[model samples]
Target: MTMTVRDLRPEVRADVEGFARVRRLALPFYLVTADSLAYDATHAHPDSHYRPLVAEADGEVIGTAQVGLVHDSPDPGQGYLNVYVHPEHTGRGAGSGLVRAAEEYLAAKGATRLYAWVLDRPGDRAFAERHGYRASRSAHFLRLDLAGGELPPLQDPPPGVELRPGTDFADDPRPFFELDSETMSDEPSDIDYEFTDYEAWLESTWKHPLFSPELTTIALVDGRPAAFSAARTDGGTRYGTVMTGTARDFRGRGLAKLAKNDSLHRARAAGLTEAFTGNDAGNGPMIAINKWFGYEICATEMRYVRELG
Candidate 1:
């Protein structure tokens, strides 16, 4: 009847699978798999000090945590620890144990501030507050039925614009990196990130296990990348758009909408059944865009911050 938390061993298939299972049960909005988990554990930047942990009760995994430092942020000594306990196994000390272990690991690495995402529910919020964390911004997880619901009709690109899949840049993905960095910098966030290292981006984002270049749609204006909708698949029927944005000069032209629509259409044609995406609560434009595509808000999570002592 005792629950204990330990570091997740990426080499062990069962350990990685268990961790992914717990996360999927707790947060269905995210796409997690054993391969993705193992890739992250092995390919993480050394400076970030990434570590995955699992909470076991009677030799069964019931909780998981992804703990790491935000090394890419301009600010120093900031870290993150997102913990999730399986819904069926709550109130068994797994959640608290995972958080405590994650905090201890982060604090030992000189982290001065820690951030976490908690489900927007009374009990979840109470747990964070009791652990000395204060709620900050919020984000919504949206779901679209690719198999059963109607999608926005695909529209042809206007004059001087062309639509292409992300695979077009298979020889080189620098353009997509530039586009991603520009749009990501403008996103409303508590931490400002600088995506200056192209090599790092290539190693982390472009080559990720879940990245689906063929399914990602890009809008080009005069042969220049103007807008893009990046897609990631769970190696199953679930497809998620990780990022979709238009270049600064291309905003308000409906190019982003066009790109996302094309991507969704492609995903559905490829046999994907569900589509998922997330938007910050304060991002009115993106939220409105997603709503226009028939996406519904399925869940919300509030960001929590705590100062390490």
Candidate 2:
């Protein structure tokens, strides 16, 4: 069993599909597709130096790593690598090989701190500890049975609020951009990100193929975007809310909940059978909201951090 690590060839359909396959097998609750992988490989911000890597044995991709610098953070030298090996091929050295390759690449690129997301299982935690990575914050992957679950009935917007699909702002998405930028700053994470580049956002997010404007919902207050639920689909029955947040000024008006519920209904109407979302473990408010919608925590991932000496 000779395992080797190399850069993912975006041009090769097999490589792309194999990487996506490994990810799907390793992290079954999340939404991932070949098209999304290909898009990120090319459209990521240049400063991030994003590289999709694969560990192959006998001409098959057995493991994958998404390695890149945290370019949006104000601080430099912060890198991240999320490595996942196919469950059937776990003991064949694919995971270790991919991790070593990722660390070397990030170190040479001047990264001082590296973070990785490891599942909360005992074996996964032990693996991270063995590699000198210490546990940090954690997050949970949640799922709702969009097809069988009964969602709360839709209600007309309160006096000053209106619900709009993301498509409504197609002519001018700057409002969406502004709302996203503001909400992201409030998100809980180890790294504080600042979204200052509208051009980059437009290129990587607005134009991405998997982003479904029709399924996304925005809550408007007095004609101003207050909160939004951004959706991503795998061009299948799987649908995920990648971001759902309320503007700082709009917090606690039930706008975020309103937006997400509307988005879920829209996804259901669009024939998406499953709804997925992620929440920081410490985010009790958001977790309560998700629970209210019948979303159950499907899986948990622990964030592990290591300092490169």
Candidate 3:
């Protein structure tokens, strides 16, 4: 059977469902849905040149790839392509075909460096090595059973601080955005990013389909957002913390931990059973916070980099 790859058709329900289905099966720790897939396809920045590709075999989408440039990074020519093949559909050449198509697309767009995340399994690592990619950093996918596990009891805010839901800032999220930008700058990563576009943040993050403002917890200092835990739900029993961070000035006060704990409690109270999150290996502080919440590492993925010629 010949494997063919093409751009994902967001308008087609089957295409979106197929892409989401494969990704869910391949990466169970992630929260993916048809609506999220469609939203990403439509709202991606033009400069990023985002493209979702599907490898089809016998009229079935057996693998998927998300290809794009690191548009928000200070450096140019850095690109990313994360490929996921249906576990049952591996060894059918779909993976290779998808990678080749993605690489060609990025290379043509003037990308000089490429990054991909491969599950830290033997076969996956070997595939990356065969493709001239070398492993760099690693990250862990963590899970917590919110329904039955014992969570740390929610505590009252300190004398000067207050805990509020993200919804409280619905009228004006600029403070939250500023706090997000500050914390994001401190995150450990291979790419350095600066969040300067408020409109893009509103469209891509604030209005995202999975974002649950009611469950997200924010820490306030003098009526300003000082720390926050952003929550995302799969519109079901699965909930995840998309981001948990504190402004640099408030870093040592444990405000981030407090915010995330409060958000998790709210999520569990609302009937979310499974909680998921990811952290870079080098993010010791964030990793320690998650550990305090009883989250265990469920899986790991390695970031692989290749210099395009």
Candidate 4:
């Protein structure tokens, strides 16, 4: 049996479904769907040269890789290739082939530094190291039983602040976009990102298939968005918090906590049973907040970096 790596054909539903299946099997903590896969492939910035590659064995996609440059980052030459192979296909050379093809593609596009997330398993770590990648920072995948766990009682907003759903801003979401951009600028990461592209954000985030605007909670200060907890659902009982943050000026006022609590309560009321989220290992404030909400660390993955000459 031979495995060959090739560009993913988004037009082919089977290819996208197979790629998403491998990702779901390898990383169950995160959300992945056919629509999301196609969106990422189609809506990616052209400057990034984003390419989703799949390893095919006997006409079946056994492994997948999302390869692209960090176009939104302030720094250049940074690229990423997140590779996932079906657990059943692990012993084969599919994973290696996918990574090699991804690296070559990014290198040809002028990427000097590459990063990938490797699950914190021994074999996964060893594979990354064998390819000259060194582990940098780590992050955890957290899960909460929204249906059974006890969540903090929802609280009314303080004076001058009011809680609203993301859908409330449907007529004009620029305010939320501004708030998101400000909060995201401070997120900890190896790559520096600037969310100055509002149009792109609208198409990619606000209009995403999984984004649950009705379930997302937003805190408004004098009718302006000050903090928010974005929610995404898989059109089923599974829900996830994609982002929860407060504006810089609104920090320390517990607005973020207030927003998240409201969102979670709404999720439970809407019949969602499971909730998931992720946090960088060093983000103490968010970690503390999640822990306070009874979310348990389910799994961890390490970010590995490699340099190409």
Cα error of candidate 3 at position 5, Å: 0.5
Name the better of 3 and 4 by TM-score.
3
lDDT of 2 at 49: 93
Residue 58, candidate 3: C-alpha displacement in angstroms: 1.2
Q: Compared with the true structure, what per-residue lDDT tens digits does model 2 show for residues 173-199?
A: 999999999998888899989998999
Q: Can you tell me which runs of candidate 4 are displaced by over 4 Å?
A: none
Model 1 misplaced stretches (Cα beyond 4 Å): none
Q: What's the count of clashing pairs in each model shown? A: 0, 0, 0, 0
Better of 3 and 4 by lDDT: 3
What's model 3's overall lDDT? 0.94
Across 196-306, the per-residue lDDT of candidate 3 in tens digits comes to 989889988899999999999999987778999999999989999989999877879989888999999989889999999999999998999999999999999999999
Q: In order, what lDDT does every prediction score?
A: 0.94, 0.93, 0.94, 0.93
Q: Candidate 1 on 154-260: residue-level lDDT in tens? A: 88789999999999999989999999999998998888898888888887889999999999998999999999999999999999999999999989999999999
TM-score of each: 0.98, 0.99, 0.99, 0.98
User: Tens-digit lDDT track for model 4 on 1-309?
Assistant: 878999999888999999989998999999889878888898887888999999999999999999999888889999999999999999799888988999998999989999999999999999999989999999999999998899999887889999999999999989999998999899988889989999888977899888999999999999878999999998879899989999988799999999999999999999999999999999999999999999999999999999998
